[model samples]
Target: MAILWKIDPAHSEIQFKVKHLMITTVTGYFRTFNLEVETETEDFHTAKRIEFTADIDSIDTNNDQRDTHLKSADFFDSANHDQLRFVGGKYESHGDEAKLHGDLTIRGITKPITLDVEFMGTVVDPYGQYKAGFTVKGKIKRKEFNLTWDAVTEAGSVVVSDDVRLMAEVQLIKQG
Candidate 1:
């Protein structure tokens, strides 16, 4: 029988990091997101489906001005595109690690992405719930998603890097 799993938001995080000024890195996270998974066993290696969505307006970088600019038409354009989504297409395992192939949609642009996944094991929580953990990492070029906003410093360094690294720690609870 197939089992359904729902992401436990309180125990999950979706974050990204990008180079700034070609020297430092700026990190940010989406405060609201969800993931759904379907599997035939408690072992996530058998997962059959996975889908994720994040609210673009929930982006938080701890800087109000930067956040505002990111939401503008130059970046994510949250006013017009409210959400980003990912649909998993395949799961390829190699020993203890796996690759999740998926289509990610951002700012109305869709592109294929492959995420490196590490299964962190499963356990029964204190609340008597079966929970599984996973760490996912990936990278993407923001410009490919129509986030073309950019600037250059007086030193000729780009203000924001086109490459963004995605990182997530997801905890899923099996639904009854």
Candidate 2:
């Protein structure tokens, strides 16, 4: 039988960094979201599957006003694009590391992406449950998703860069 698990919010983080003001970069993340994964691993031949989804409206950079502005029509437009989803992807392990591929959808745009993943191994938690952890990181241009909001600086440079870096550390609990 295969095993399934859900992401523990208290153990996961989703964040992004974008160049701002033509000199520095700003980072932010969502305070709430969930993901579920399934696996049939009893041996090397059996690989795991993962599905990730997120809520755009929950974004926070520690400022409520800025968060509200991000939800407006200029950025996420959360009312029209409430959810961002990733179709579960598979990775073949190579010496303790893996490369995961999937389609990431955001703001009505979907693009194929590849994430360099590392299996951080699993353990039996103090709570008496088995858990697995993974780290996934990748970069995608916001313009590809039509999220091209930006500003011009007096020095002839753009206020915000086009490339956005996505980084996440996720923990999946083992299901019986």
Candidate 3:
């Protein structure tokens, strides 16, 4: 029988990094997100179904002005599309590394994305909960998702880079 697992929000985080001013990097994170996985065994390599969703409005870049801009129509347009989702399509495992292929939907646009996953092993927590950890990394082009707003500095440097890197440190608790 397949066992269901839920993401432990307190132990998991979804973060992203992007180049700004064509010279510096800016990091941000989504404070609210959820991940669900269904597997036949304790081994995550056997995962059959994986789904994730993140609240766009929970984006925090530290700078209030930048956070507000990110939530505006120029970027995520949180008012119209308040959430981003991912549905797993395939799971390929090679030793301790894996690739998770899925369809990522942002601003209503669905695109194929593959995330590199590192199995961080599993353990029983002090409270007796079965837990698994993973490190996921991926990249996507903002323009491909209709996040085309941009500006050029007087010196010709771009305000933001087109590529965005996604990083996640996730902990999943096995459910009875």
Most accurate candidate by lDDT: 3
lDDT of 2 by residue, 59-166 (tens): 988888878977887788899999788875667678667877788898989989988777788889999888888887889898888787877867778877888888
lDDT of candidate 1 vs native? 0.94
RMSD (Å) per prediction: 0.8, 1.7, 0.6
List candidate 2 segments past 4 Å from native: 42-48
Worst 10 residues of 3 by lDDT: 39-48
Scored against the true structure, residue 41 in model 3 reaches a CA lDDT of: 88
| After superposition, candidate 3 runs with Cα above 4 Å error | none
Task: Write candidate 1's Cα lDDT for 29-76 as tens digits.
Answer: 999999999998877778899999999999999999999998899999
TM-score of 2: 0.92
Please provide the root mean square deviation of candidate 3 (C-alpha atoms, Å): 0.6
Displacement of residue 80 (Cα, Å) in model 1 is: 1.0
Model 1 residue pairs with clashes: none
Return the TM-score for candidate 1, rounded to 2 decimals: 0.97
lDDT of each: 0.94, 0.81, 0.95
